[model samples]
Target: MDDSNENVLTGSASQSLLIKPDISTPLIDSKRIDLQTLINKFHNQLGDKNWLKYQSIFSSFILGKLSRNEFENEITKIINSNLLINFHNQFILSNLANSVRINPSPNSHISGFGFNNNNLFNMNNSNKKKKNLNNYKFNNQYEVLKTNIMSLPVKERRRIKNIKRDSGKSNLLSANSSLYITNPQNNKSSSQPREVITGNAVTWSQDIMTGFQTLLASESYELPDKDTLNYRMTGIMREHGLFGSLDENSINVMSMAIESHLKTIIEETIDLVRYRKSKYDEN
Candidate 1:
């Protein structure tokens, strides 16, 4: 959103307006936004006239300090005493109801917030059945993480290099021409050749596998299929510049390391299932 440091390009007689750069820009400041941060943003945007009344209760519910039943009871009292007459108030009430309806079944309807047989939430969640917290299923989590990593958009670093190179060439053009252009950001003093530094896949693989192990250990889940996991892992390894460019030898090294760790995880998960069953028999 900050455009103050962008480079500008101009043509001779047509140098009337500033042209925006073609470089990719991030939509948000960071990848993650916490609940409190979101609440502050909403408060600033929507103001506090009606917000002040329910901010405390809403914050508690959102932060998991208040249970669903308690939140519904508190909100109902507010709705009864202060009727939501306008569309804005009704919309706010509906949103509040929606925030707590995390796992509505297909036939479930939105109630207790003036919504008349609303199946919107139900329809949205119909495809996604509620997952039991204690069910030991590691396959789904692994697949989700794999999908996220694979779907990550690759930034065209080459395009930036080309743009900087072309911008430098403008200085060689005839100054007497009717049109002229220059790039202050790509001036001769700062026009140094950038080195393509590849990241260490061996070290990165260690950390990546460790993190995945931690995730699986903490969660109860079924073990993922080895062949499917191997297939996805192979694709990830073959992915160019993911962990940076690795030579044939280095590629084999990293692949072996990750595969070895994955094998250990599969063994541990089987042991865990056996342990859980033994404990249940004793109980």
Candidate 2:
């Protein structure tokens, strides 16, 4: 009885082991690429004749005419032909080059005064017009007008008052710009009030420079047309613009600057195309 029971147990265990399927086994019946047919289709068209034999060998291996080890060795020899080895070496050298850089993202930001300080610099909102005349300083004459304004309704009174106040303020400031008027009783310059700058005023040179920067950064920043170039060049001869009131020597220096700028742009563009072409060739 004991011997028979042990035999039954052994038989059942053997059956279970046989029933279990291997999960690690590869799907060898998966669809394979027809390298031979593909190569033959291109054989006549292909300038490189070296690839023709590889297709036959690959097909033979696929058809069970060659062992896996023999196929691997032979195919490796074919794929790593002189041309392929040179291409692979070139790829490796390029990867090494891309990994190394003399300067990392050097042009990611601007780097100059009033332009490169953390971000592109801009003037404060001093030039923006105020919504009201509350901050405007009126002259003594506006006081008499304000008294006459009191007779009007509240909303109308306020509107008329502001208009008159602003108008008087503008006239007074313009008059004060030319004259350093002092108190008649004292007749001393020390007693005179210093002229206050109005927010509407801006330096023309600074404004021009800011505009130039915007123009350069704009979408229209292609090489200037002849008319546009002529217009810009003529500005140098102006008596009031950024390049205005300059001597002949200064104008010549500025012309050199324009030439240098255009030359640099063209050369850098050439270098960019060359670099891209070299990278593509390596690939």
Superposition TM-score, candidate 2 onto the true structure = 0.21
Residues 155-259 of candidate 1 have per-residue lDDT tens digits of 544443356433432111121211001123223565444321111222333322222222221132434344324433443443211443334565456566767
Q: Tens-digit lDDT track for model 2 on 34-57? A: 222222333323223343344345
Per-residue lDDT value at 203 in model 1 = 32
Clashing residue pairs in candidate 2 (N, C-alpha, C atoms within 3 angstroms): none
Misplaced by over 4 Å in model 1 are: 1-245
- Candidate 2 lDDT (Cα, 0 to 1): 0.35
CA RMSD (A), model 1: 27.3
Give each model a TM-score: 0.18, 0.21
lDDT of each: 0.35, 0.35
lDDT of 2 at 103: 29
TM-score, predicted candidate 1 vs. hidden true structure: 0.18
Shift of residue 255 alpha carbon in model 2, Å: 0.4
